[model samples]
Target: MSKILDAFLNENLEALRDQGLYNEIDAVEGANGPIIQVNGKKLINLSSNNYLGLATNEELKQVAKKAIDEYGVGAGAVRTINGTMDLHVKLEEKLAEFKGTEAAISYQSGFNCNMAAISAVMDKNDAILSDQLNHASIIDGCRLSKAKIIAYKHSDMDDLRTKAKEAKESGLYNKIMVITDGVFSMDGDIAKLPEIVEIAKEFDLITYVDDAHGSGVTGKGKGTVKHFGLEKEIDFQIGTLSKAIGVVGGYVAGKKNLIDWLKVRSRPFLFSTAVTPGDVAAITRAVEMIMESTELHDRLWENGDYLKAGLKKLGFEIGASETPITPCIIGDEKLTQQFSKRLVEEGVYAKAIVFPTVPKGTGRVRNMPTAAHTKEMLDDALAIYEKVGRELGVIN
Candidate 1:
């Protein structure tokens, strides 16, 4: 409608295409699982975040259907209004238990949880010491808080300590918070939470951890805080119900006072409609399963190890990944995109990560091996990787 708006959008879109940065979304034809059908082609999927492969679990699906039958499709109103149902309450209780916290509060999504919780607690009077490589959601959350943000070297405890000391001694803010991702998704490295906790204790800083990628994958499905046995020490533990839990929504687990504060002050929770009853039920069931057994978690790691071993054997430069997330590094961005395209053509579906998402010249095809993937599926995916890597001169 507006010519200036049109021109601005067109110019930016063309620039993205010209730079080979435009992402083309692929439509999945059926359930997203170990194997997915994309554009009429069946491929071994290594691009999904369904860590434990519970996204398509039959039991969870059944529970969701039952919930739908009892409570309908939607929650009907905002959480502060009439939307907080029995299922919602139960999910929060289950999340607190799972995360080993005194209380928990849920939101529509993980992104919203970060955006809501961070700003609600920290404000202009505070300073946030964040990890350089933390998730974009954390960055946006900090900005929204209007706090002085000081970024430290990624996972470098020394840098964190230095920044913390400076911020505290300056007396520029009333409160200081240190936030980091429990597991750095891109490199698949676990954060040094123990060292961070020690630093926080020394400075009396409020500690926050976004463990969206760690829940159900670490700490025997409890999460990274439990992984390091610092459940009571950390103040905020944010997680998603969508990733390993295989549903929708996010939550912040902490003390009862913090949870109560979020319930009243978090704008998203107060104004937005609550998560669907089916999703809440499914997520609760999924967490129950994770706590009940460690079978899925073990299978996920086994598959990750098998795939990593195969890629290394084929001479591909798989980067330093301590978790199930693997990255086949291809230094050039265009070539990295081409490598991912070739993988898709050969019956594997892994996506490329380039600048903005990752540093320039470190473009990579990130693979996420799930618990549902059988050895045969992984072997086939490995074969495709080797073929593509060798053909593209990415490997010997």
Candidate 2:
């Protein structure tokens, strides 16, 4: 390695250390099931995105194990070459049906899907009106597309409409598109998809909704598109298999032509190896479970409401959230991180999200209460939070 590269890394590391921003990874000792063993201690898990508690589901595990027995382990090659296993095809078909779309295509991760799908159809000559608080993957995808990205105010329909009008009238780009996350992960606010659809229709803007957090959480677990009843209006619907699906991968669901175009053009889909057969089979089963029953979904909401009510009763500032993803807002970054550390020490596992991940000083302890959490578990977590808050002088 070059001496110059070594020096550059040293300088950056020193700066991060000085600012107390350098994070040391904490390894979980055991399974990521409902409860996890971290630092050799069993804790109430409130940090996982396994919303429906399907990550350790017996049926999903069996399906994956069976596929591993038959298909071995890896996909062997890129999809365009030879990695397109029957399992892959069937999973995509199931995803399309789940999303209520004509077709769908899967990627290695939700992050990869955003990068692949955004640029496959858009180019430098195009313009994109993106929500200010869209996910990091979407922002990176827009940048990679080489499109003129104009950020509209978060969840502000008027701002989106104004920007769309200006971009359309300029005629400087070949096409215009608008994109937003179906649910803002930080604040847990659902996107104003209905109004966005109206704006897209009026201005002929292509619509994209990355429903990473909304799937298996909204519209009886059908997702935001179904929640808003805009199955045909939105041009692109993106979701993650890693979240509620309890597996690893991402997908784009839309009209048949869009799916075909992405399959031919998306770089990750064409260049990277396909998801393993085990993952594909497991995810297909998870999707089927979601489609067949509302039990897990109901339990998730029940746990969420219990936690939110408990936090509120304790006088914690929980922001304007309409979904199960709850944030206990703490203003200062250092204090927020300290609060998280204290919680972990006390046996609760929520993490602190600070500036850059969220806005500056809007730091919070993000809690993801899953269906696996019982009322007693939530009560125990609330007690820990109360104790930590009082010890830290954040609460009485």
Candidate 3:
């Protein structure tokens, strides 16, 4: 290794350590479910985004296993080449149908989809009005597009309108687009899509919603775009299969022309190998299951409401969350990290979010209530929370 590179890495790592910003990755010993075993300790899990609990469903596993037996494992090449399988085409068809769009295109991961899709359409001459708190993937995508990105205040429709107007009126670009997360993951707040749509209409700005955490948790599991009944209004309806869908990969559901363009032009799609057969199979089965029964979705919401009410009653400042994503707003970053460590020691495994991931001074402990969590499990987790809260002097 180069001595200069080693010194640079060491200096940055030491800075992170001194600031207590470096996170240590803990290996989970068993399956990730409502509860996960980390370092030989079984903890009541509140850190997962597996909302529908489709990740461990037996049927989904069977589908994946069957695909593996038939199609081997990897796609073996890029989508534009011989990597495209019949199953890939099938999955795309299912996703488009699920999202109620003209056509859909899939990518290796949700992050890549954002990176691939945004740049596929928009160029440097264009301008993108992005939400201040939109997912990092979307921000990176906007950057990759070379579009002039102007950030509007989080979910502020008026601010979006003002920026969109400014971007258009200044005659600085050819087209303007507004990109936002369907649900802000950090705050668990739902996006005001109705108002956003109205602004987009007013400014003729193309609408893009990255619903990575919205699908399989909202709209009877259809997604946020459908939840707001704006299926036809949004230009790009983006989502992830890894979360509630119980698998991996991401997609862009939109007009057929757009899908076709992405298939031809997107760098990741052209360069990266297709998703594995097992993941594709499992995701397709997950979609089918959601379409068939509301059992999981209903249970997920029940747990969410239950947990939210429990946290609020405990005197924890659970932020303005409308979904299963909940955050215990603890201010100090170091204290928040310590709190999370204590929670894990107490057999609860929710994680901490600090500066950079969230704004400085707004450090929080995020919880994700999933369908797999029973009331008994949630109650046990809450008991641990109460114990930890008192022990840490966070609650009386």
Candidate 4:
């Protein structure tokens, strides 16, 4: 590294370490299931975003293996080029059906999906009214749009309405869009889409909802937009294939025209290599499984409720989460990091989430209970939480 660059990196690295903000990443030894092996210790995992546990499904694995034989490994090129495979078309079709939209377009991942989709449509002349606590992807995508971004208080409909009205009345913007996460990942609060839609209509604003965390966990696995019955109302419905779908891509589900536009305009779709045939096939299978039955979704909720109850009983502040994602809030950054370290030491793999991810002083160890976890597993994990809580003075 160059001298100036090396000095800059060293300074920031030391700053993060001194403040207890540097995170130590542990490599999972095998499959990222309910039980994870990290550093030779097998622990009950509450750290993954695999809400439905389809990532390690045996049936999906076989499907992917079969796909490799039929369609080969790579997609060959980008979507606009020779990269768009039949499997790609099939996955997008499945995605549209899965999200209950007229059509859909896929991306390499959820984060880039946001970046590509947002910048594709909005520009400097337009304005994007985003939720304050929207995911980092959404925040970055909005910035990339080059649009004047106005942040509304998270899920606060009154503030959203006021901002929408102001943006519309100002006439300073040619097109205005209101964007929010269908499910706020940190707090697991469902977005006020009904009210947001109403506000959008009142101001003729375009609506975008990134239901990345809500798919397969809400709306009986259809997603948050379908959960609210606003499939026809929201212009953009973005989601991740990695989360509940348990694959490796992202997509925007909307009207056929919007999908068509994204196909041509979204930079990732135009330039990036499409998902591999094996992964695309697996993703389609996962979506089909989710659509076929709510058994997994129901099981996930049951597990979430059980874990939340256990954590609350232990006097940890499990934030207001309507969905399965549970965050055990610890106010101080260092204590939260130490708390997570202690949990891992005691045989649980819940990691600490701190600054820049969430606001300062609101550090937490977010717990994700999936459909694959048994009651026995959750009970064991809860027992670990209790032991750690008492030892760390986080609970009575």
Which regions of candidate 2 are displaced past 4 Å? Answer: 1-3, 18-20
Please report how far candidate 2 places residue 261 from its true position, in Å.
0.6
lDDT of 4 by residue, 322-354 (tens): 998999999899999999999899999998999
Candidate 1 local lDDT, 126-189, one digit each (tens):
9999999999999999999999999999999999999999999998999999999998899899
Every model's TM-score: 0.99, 0.98, 0.98, 0.99
Error of 1 at 111 (Å): 0.4
Better of 1 and 2 by TM-score: 1
Comparing 1 and 4 on lDDT, the stronger one: 1
lDDT of 1: 0.93
The 10-residue segment with the lowest total lDDT in model 2: 16-25
TM-score order of candidates, top first: 4, 1, 3, 2
Model 3 scores a TM of 0.98
Clashing pairs in 4: none
Candidate 1's error at 130, in angstroms? 0.4
Candidate 1, position 335, lDDT? 90
Full-model lDDT, candidate 2 = 0.93
